[model samples]
Every structure is written in structure tokens, then in C-alpha cells.
Target: MPLNKQFNKDVCRNLFAKDSRRLFLKRTLNSATITLAVSSGLLLPIQAIAAWNEVAFAATNLQTAIKSVLGTDLSRASDKISIKIPDIIENGAIVPVTVSSTLKEVSTITLFSEKNTAPLVAQFELDKDCIAFISTRIKMSQTSNVIAIVTARGNNYSARKKVKVTIGGCGD
Candidate 1:
């Protein structure tokens, strides 16, 4: 073989050998770390940090749902909270809804479709540093009031808007 060709072949072999060695080291280190974690009980099954309120979500009636979620059926009307939703919706399945609050220390925002089988549509938990604003889509069973309850400073404030749905999102 020519000197150049022989040199190229040797270089290619060395490159491949180095790559294989690097790969073997990486795989071995990864396996060892995983084994250590497993043996030391550091790799535990995922446990939910937040608990789900089954009763609130499962409530069929608006009053029951509100009571379960908020610990009471009563909420004071507040102008500080704004609900942006179409007065008339063509489709009930995907109704655009946005809830924003100017109230301080807003911790949670819950939505309810008054006429749905399950009145509770969605609930959001806000962090201390998070903005008290949420935009989402909710389903409406019929033409009914879309209520938004905002929890701020351990008190509940509410706002509602009447939404007319031409087609029901929830099954009739």
C-alpha cells in the first residue's frame, strides 16, 4: 500500500478505537450511577405533590361543585376580576374563555359552566409570583352563565357572563 493510504487507514482505525472506548466508558458510568441510585432508594416512584379534590370535580350541580371547591357556596361579586368570553358561541365544544384578576394575592381561579352535567370546567392554582391571569377553553352544555371564581387573600371573588351556545358541547 502507498504510504498515504496506509497512514489514512491507521488514523481511521485509531479514531474508531477511541470512539468505541469513549462510548463504553459513558455507558458504564451511566449504568453505575443508575444502579447506585436504585440501590440507595434515591430513585423512588413518582408521588403527586399536589392532591386532587375528587369531590369538587365530580359534583354534578353548580351549587354542590362550588361548595366543594370553595368550602362554601357564596362568593362576593368583584369588578376587579374580568372574564373575556364571547356573548354568542357557534360551537359549545371549544368555547374560548379568559379570566384575569386585578385582585392581590390571587391563589386560584376556578371556572364553572352552569348548565353542564358537571358544572366544574377547570381550576387553576397560581403561585405567589405568578400573574393572576389565565386564558383557556371550556365546554358549555347549553346557553348558560359562565362563572369565574377567583381566590385571593383567602377570600373568594366572582364574576359571570352569559354565553349563548348555538351547538351544545356536552352531550344532550
Candidate 2:
């Protein structure tokens, strides 16, 4: 009777071993599939979020960043482009700015601060169906000149405003 009980236990162990091996293989395959998906950047639904312009964002000055983003440094100062921002801000952390263009066929609007560490602040891409206007809050390191560049029909138009900041946004 003892020998029979021992033999039964050994058979049960052998039967469960195959199930554990299968489970291990299944777990390994699932892990590999997830790794591949993440490596290929398929986890994000929007592809544009992953696509970043390094040159424009990494530029240290206003001119370089503008050239990197707009492909040219020459922009004509336009009266048709209106920039609405406070001349003086108590806190540099939240500075409201609105840019509107009366020019036809506006394609893009880009904002910059001349004295900021990285000047290129924000950019808005517009199509024919949309209006040529953008409003947003941007941080200013100190008292600097804020510039708005509008691109319309292959021509670049610009407007600049000087802002006085009482408190520096860059923790100065």
C-alpha cells in the first residue's frame, strides 16, 4: 500500500510539470510581445506627439530657434498681426498672450521671448479652414521682448512687445 501511494504522488508531480512549463513559455511570449510593441512606439495612439523638432527646441537663442522652426530669419514686421499682452506682469510665471492675424492664408504662428534661455516658446499650425489666431500663457525668465511671427502665403510677418516682469519665472 505505501509503494502504491508513493507512485501516485510521483505521477501527479509529473503531470503538473508540463502545465508549469507551458505557463512559463506563455508568460515569456507575452513579455516579448509587449517589449516589441513599446520599442516600435505603437503604444501611443498619436504619432505626432512622439515627433519632436530637436533643433528648434534645443536652440539657445531667439534667432537660431526661429531659423530652425521657420527655415529663414528674414521676417517683415507687419501691422496686420496684432499682439495682445500686458506691458507689465507682476508674476512672470503666467503671462497671457494673444496673437491674431488679419493676413489671408495664415499657415502658422510662433511665439518667442528674446531673453529666455530657450527663446522658441510655442507654435500653432493652422490650415485653411481654421482662423489665424492663438492665445496661450507663457513663462518669462525676466523682462524681455516677446515676439510673435506669423506665416501666411509663404511670407513671414512679425510683431514684438516688451514686457516688464517683477518676479522672474526662471527662479532667479
Candidate 3:
């Protein structure tokens, strides 16, 4: 039962010391493994993706501008995109427009008002991997066609809706 009885005191003491040394070595090795992983770039967190591109802003007409940005013709009506606006904006100081696309792999989305002097209001650049979707506010000179153009995977698509203004909110 007693190691000391079977072996000499010095020998038993040596065996106990050897076991303790092995434990220390094991802990040190484990710590070093973690350090190596971080140094080798295997433990870093990924950065957030920014989806946006700044491209040409040109459109003679709403459709042309939509084409210039998206590179394809839009559907007559699509179930994929939904454009939301007030039936009548009593004030034009700040008109809200919301555009959402159910379509997959959308690259960019833009909004334009046909009647405005400069029809091209805003251009959105979706990063290469971003799906098409956006919401924004645009100015309207009068009751006009507010167009929503979406670019997805190098193809162009869009939707349009006419909104009525009870009062001239665009500082007429």
C-alpha cells in the first residue's frame, strides 16, 4: 500500500516529482496552442459587409434614368417589389417613400420622381453580394410618377406608382 515501503524514500520522492513536472508541461503546451491559432489568423472575426456603389447619375426621363442605372427594362408590374407612399401628402417638406424587393440577389435600388426638373434623385449601390432593397424620401414638384428601380445580378428591374399631393409640399 505504501510506495515508500516497496521502494526507497528517495526513489518514491523522485516518482512524485516526475508526475508534477508532466502536469506543468501539459498546461504550458495547451497555452501555446491557443497563441499559435491567433498568430496564424485563424481566430479573427469577419468585418461587416458594406453594400453600396456610387455610379453615374443621369436620366432624361424616369424610365431612361432607371435604365441608365439598372441596365435593363422593368416589368409592367412585379410582385417582387412594393412601393409605399401616402395617398396625399398634405405637406411636401418631407415626403417618405419605402421600397422593398422580395426578389433574390439584388445588387442596387434607386428612387426617382418623373416630374421633378432633375429626375435623377438618388442612386444606390449594393455591394456585389447584397440583395436588392432600399427605402428613401424624395422630393416631388407636383403629383408625379415615383419610380423604384432595382438592379440585381447585372439585370435591371423596376416598379412605379403615382402619388397625389393635396398641397404643394415641394415649396412650389
Candidate with maximal TM-score: 2
- TM-score for predicted model 1 compared with the true structure: 0.72
**In model 1, how large is the Cα lDDT of residue 157?**
96
Error of 1 at 47 (Å): 4.7
Clashing pairs in 2: none
By lDDT, the better pick of 2 and 3 is: 2
The digit string of per-residue lDDT tens for model 2 on 97-133 reads 9999899999999999988888999888898998989
Single out the weakest 10-residue window by summed lDDT for candidate 2: 44-53
Report how far residue 144 has shifted in candidate 1, in Å.
0.3
| Per-residue lDDT over 57-87 for candidate 1, one digit per residue giving the tens place of the 0 to 100 score | 8999999999999999889999999999989
Error of 1 at 143 (Å): 0.4
Per-residue lDDT of candidate 3, residues 11-111 (tens digit): 87899899899999999999899779767766643323433323425445655665566565554456688889887776655679988888777776777
Candidate 3 similarity to native, TM-score: 0.58
Best by lDDT: 1
Model 1's lDDT to the true fold?
Answer: 0.93
**RMSD of every prediction:** 9.7, 5.4, 14.3
